[model samples]
Target: MISAQLPILQVLLPLLAAPLCAILRGRALPHALSVGTVLLSLLVTVGLLIRVESTGTISYAIGGWPPPIGIEYRVDQLSVIVLLIIQGVAAAVLVGGGASIVREIEATRAPLFYALFLLNLTGLTGMVLTGDLFNLFVFLEISSLSTYVLVALGTDRRALLAAYQYLVIGTVGATFYVIGVGLLYMMTGTLNMADLADRVAGVEESTTIRTAFAFMIIGIGVKLGMMPVHFWLPNAYARAPSVVSAFLAATSTKVAVYIMLRVVFEIFGVPMFLATHLSEIIIGLGILAMVVASVTAIFQDDVKRLLAYSSLAQIGYILFAFGLATEPGVTASVLHLFNHGLMKGALFLALAAVALRAGRTRRTDLDGLGQAMPLTMLGFTLAGLSLIGVPGTVGFISKWYLLEAAFDRDGFIIAAIILGSSLLAILYVWPLVERAYFRKRDPALPPVEEAPLPMLIGIWLLVGANLLFGVWPDLATGLAERSALLLLGGAR
Candidate 1:
């Protein structure tokens, strides 16, 4: 029975716990409930992943209704991998964020905050698990709405403005997505993804289908922070509560990428997508994002803002890989998705520790932090190296696959661009390293200490993951290879 209900339980557990969190009276209770809920979901996701690996895809229909009519929850190689990342990161953030939240958020609002956090988790998990296009939009809104509130919960007044900006842009993106879904539904008379995939193949040459594809990509691109549509990300991350920043940085955009992958390969069919100029256009925009966003990150004064821009650049790398449309290319993209989550989650959690002790994460404020908060800064450094794609880091593994994919395509220029982009990451990361290690401490500032043990544990958990996955990448690489094969095979 437990094995049979894993799909619904993965989503329902969090959905039920969220309301319980809201009704809970105290900070500790809500925090425990939220963390427990996320951890439980994580365990379920692990079970689902193992089951999928051993037994193939698991599909559970709602109300015993069949496909093309009743809603379905499907677990496959791709969905399970994404589910593990999402829940794993959420659990870590909640655990590590406890002390920081006490300092940054009002005590009275803590329950509400945790409630919203769980709701966000529910939406993200549902978005990946559901096999219906309309249900995807519903889950997307649930997540997006909760995220907007959580972003606004920060102490900074600017958080409100940041949340507002994200709300406007996010709504527009969702609207565009639904319009596309509506178009597809009208053309095919069904919203089930598998059914749509079958139906869409027959209308591959229709102008309506092509137009729907355009709308869907642009819509999802905004959510994924694709360059030119990424203006809302920097401020949102920089201003939101640190935990919220870490959670969003780690999981949200990756879900958008998963949706894009589903739409591209499962619904639209890769052959049709690649046949037009769309692939080239996506690749060009991705390259532009890699170069332009990295350059922009180098000049940012706020550390969170800098990391936010860096994320935009990293998204470019994933898009660049996906644009290649080959087995190796998709593998690199999927691998990077998991690796980036580890790197960014550690970085943001470390920064949260910094904010708790050092007040702010501006470059100037972080000067000489290596002496006062060595462990936190050390974790930051390790994650930074991963960002730079240094040897023995998870970042290197992804870049290695990406470079191989580029070479496989015989695109020497694209490979050069990949190498050049890593240099830009070093350029931006080095100044922070120097400030932490070499700059003199200000005598007037209060004496500071390392982050609390709980926070340090969270930071190092991900830091250790970075090193473990980096040194022995077979786990991530093998899973990615299987996922890529599944996607490519399905596309045909």
Candidate 2:
């Protein structure tokens, strides 16, 4: 018998292990459990993905009850793709972060770090796997609450303030999401996402449903770090411990974007809204994010904040593709989702290594780093180049597809915006490369050594993956295309 328990075990292993991490109280023990739990989850994710692909969609009726009556855990194409990215990237980050985390966070707090990290993992996995909307919100809260605590764990005093600010903003976002879910429940009398999709289709013109949709978008927008709603992100990324920044950058916002896609394309009945102006709203916001955030990123002095702003801009590209609401557009968005996770994860780990070796990450502080820590900075440069959409890198593939989609819609102006933003990315990234390589060495600072073996191995894993995906875009794009169709209410 196929274990109906696998899905629950997938989540519970990490969820239940979190407290044990704290109890084991041994520094090495927690790290071992964290890595082991994530690896096991990755295996589970792979099994689920293959099972869904081969057997068609599988919905495990929680407690053996049917949907709209009992909770269901549905493994669909879209969810499977997200599940793979979350668990896969998580496993990679934990491998890369072993040494970096120990250096950056206090040893006494190591167990707590692993505990919170596991809780966050549980929340993200739960958010993706559940078929119920209210359950999504509950998982969202679990992720956000754990994230706020993780951010606070930084050694920097400012980490506390950053976490507090994120707490206020994140709380407000979660409250809005709950209100939206409440409204959705009021409209359909059912909280199951699939059931709600069926019901919302019949009431396509209802004002209540539309309002609920709007609230949910705004709520998820904050979490996704969508523009104007994204004020909390830069500081949180900049001030949090390096490992936290890397993990959150790789998975958190990407999962939030998955929620938005599910709501817009799956739950909302895509055919009903395809003719509406909602795409224009998304396009407008995305354009604003691309132009404004990229411009802002170009001017940051701190490397971490610069990457944070760049992340906001990258998200704009993903959303822009989604806003186009075409197969090509959605496919590009999904491809970029995976690509950006790799790029940002590698970049942040490199940054952690720099901060560990040099005691700072200010752009000026990075002067002559190429000479001192050639391998580390080379990894950073490669990831940065990918971010610039250089050929033979994952970033280039995403930009090529996004621009292609824009052209398909005869959106020359938007195409120009996309290209213009790529140039802005160049402006931000090139300066760091120049400073690291061309500028003279600072005499007061000693020669930098390579990042520890664990850090190098971790960073290389992501770097190699980034290049492999770039060369063979078909791997991700094919999966994304299939997932995109499933998201569009099973549209063929």
Candidate 3:
């Protein structure tokens, strides 16, 4: 019975566990429940991916009602790939976060934290799986609301401020998305994405449809932490708990990028998006974000904040790929989306270990950390190499494809921008390497030890995956190629 309902079960398992977590009192139970629930969801996701790969897309109608009216849960190669990333990251973070959560959150609030984490996971999974735009908005809010609370649960007082700022910014983005949806519904009289795609083609020349496109793009851009509107991200990631930072850094913006890809190439179609000169605008912004954000990361004193900026820069790379509006371009974007998730998840989890030992992640705090926490710092270095696009790292595979895409279009300048921005990554990452290895420890400080075994397990899992995928990228590239073809094929 559950096998027949895998699409809904994948999301429902986490959603159901969230409230149970809230009602439960014991910290251990809630943590265990949360981890168990996500692991279950991950198993379901794997099943779904296998099923989809063998049988093609899966569509489940809520309440036995058909689509174009009732809500639909859809699973395709594109969404299943994202589902794996979201669930994989969430499960790993929860498993590794036990020790850190004990130190970082109050005992009484711990269950609620786990509850919120599961809820956030539910929302993200729903957003990717849902086939209806209005349902997508509903899930988006579920995830956003949960994210706000999770951010506010941080030990730092500044967390409250960061959550409030994100609430304001995120609400505006959501509102913009809904308004766009309303316009599309107004024009097509349908909320189903597949139906809308069919209906949208007829109205492509309509000013209303064009306006809707603009609203949706900007809304997703805000969520994607695109340049200029990305102010909320650094503080949110910097001040949130380490687990929250790792999860959001890896999953949230990447989901937004997925929505953007769906809307632009799947719904709006590449020709329509390019017709408005939006592609050119996006390409320019992508370059600006890559250079500007990477340069800013170089100057940040806080290690998390630096990575936060680095995330923004990575988003720029994905955006640049999308702006190319070609099949290989989309393939590069999708590949980077997965690769960046692996790289950033490993980096942040490693930093979480450092925070567990040092109690903070400022640059000065990490000084001479190499000797004190050699394993943790080594994991950080391995992931950092990926961030710098070193060969035999996942980051290199993505950037190489990106460079090829740029060169294919006779965009030598774009290729140079990609190379130059990577150099900026070195500028920011080198300081950490130097501080951790080259600098001497402040003898006045107490001795620090390596991260707990569970934490080390989580960090190394991601780092190992990065290296493994870097050397053998066929799996990621194959899925990405399929996704790009599906999007460009207009199969929704």
Candidate 4:
């Protein structure tokens, strides 16, 4: 039955569509195929989430082979929620991304571009679905490779350099990750996550295991763009085509965070993670990222770069909450993960609209855009408010849960720091409004109307979710609570 096959079908839909996209003859067909693929994948993902809620975790083995021997695809409360985030964002960006894509990417390369996007989706989804650590590495590379190519496809010449930088660093990260996986396999003799979880208990004290743990964290942290290792993100987002910027910003690092969660809590066990005081180090890094990245963002002239740096600060929030690992803390972390995706997706898609009409995305380039493109700028403003954690927005809801978690732990300084860091968001966020609404339009700039309808739909869809979840957050909160419990229970 279709219900029983949801796990594989969720992955296979995008996987099959990717190759078809590469060979498609024309722009419309490939774009439609990409949109349809992601839409179908989203539905499958939704079904998978519902089934998991009703029946608990679902594990599907490949080739009728049992888990620990055959490759397995597992869906649980945590993975299913993450799957929803991935497919949901992917669908929104693709369905509404056509105008931006046509503007930036050459018509000749359209099919391949769609191909890479679907491949990227396949890999990210697979990374969430797979039950083997080594399999995760494989999926990680698939997504990373596709992402590097997609970054290179930007109309801006700097995009190639940005892609190269990410390639060099991403390759290093992947190497570190694979080495860690190899060490884990050597010690436990199994790559299956469930089996390794059982086997790792006996060897938790081994020096090799400890070293492997460190390697994994460093590797995943680089992919996560956590503070010092984030050299590639700003330029990459700044130079890449607006749609690529939107998609990767919204989904890529979020998936890496999910992978980190699975490895840290489910595979390695939280007690071991906490015993090393790595949790403290993580919280410290989060705090530093919050203050430092927000400050750095305030200086950026390019809109995408500004948001990219802001993303690091947001990542810091997620990291800080994750390190707390209490039910409330983890709940906040999970909620913020999804909420942040909506925020970034809306912002970047709006950037695409800016580039389409204004010829660029610099702060100065946006003068009088509020009048020329009222809908797009207003949507951007709403998403920016979410980023700043304004009341009645998803961003505010995330911060509310985060503050509650910090108070539960009696960490007033952490709570103060969280609130103070959001104030920094205002510094960067306000200028966008100021430039759009207050300044006179430059005489030389061409007269322009609103962005194409498809693109506007994409931008506003995410903005609507920002408000919808902000005002009615029961669904996101319920999922986050279940995922938080699953993570905490798995750690124990």
Q: Give the per-residue Cα lDDT of candidate 4 at 490.
A: 69
lDDT (Cα) of model 2: 0.87
List candidate 3 segments past 4 Å from native. none
* Per-residue lDDT of candidate 2, residues 301-335 (tens digit): 98999999999999999999999888889988888
Could you list the CA RMSD of all candidates, in the order they appear? 0.9, 1.6, 1.0, 1.0
Score each candidate by Cα lDDT: 0.92, 0.87, 0.92, 0.91
Regions of model 4 farther than 4 Å from truth: none
- Residue-wise C-alpha lDDT for candidate 4, range 199-231, written one tens digit per residue: 999999999999899999999999989877989
How far residue 143's Cα lies from its native spot in candidate 3, in Å, is 0.3
Model 2, residue 64: what's the lDDT? Answer: 84
Q: Encode model 1's per-residue lDDT on 1-492: one tens digit a residue.
A: 788999999999999999999999879999988888988898999899889989998889977898778999888888987887898889888888899999998988999999999999999999999999999999999999999999999888999999999999999999999999999988999999988988999888988999899999999999999888999999899999999999999999999999998999889878887887788888888899999999999999999999999999999999999888889999999999999999999999999999999898889878899999999999999999999999999999989999999999998999999999999999999999899999976879887899999899889988999999999998789888888998888745
lDDT (Cα, 0-100) at 151 in candidate 3: 93
Residue pairs that clash (backbone atoms under 3 angstroms), model 1: none
Model 3 per-residue lDDT tens digits across residues 232-335: 99999999999899999999999999999998887889889789999999988999999999999999998999999999999999999999988889999999
Candidate 3 has a TM-score of 0.99
Ranked by TM-score, the better of candidates 2 and 3 is 3
Poorest lDDT segment (10 consecutive residues) of candidate 1 = 483-492
Query: Would you estimate the TM-scores of all the predictions?
Result: 0.99, 0.97, 0.99, 0.99
Error of 2 at 179 (Å): 1.2
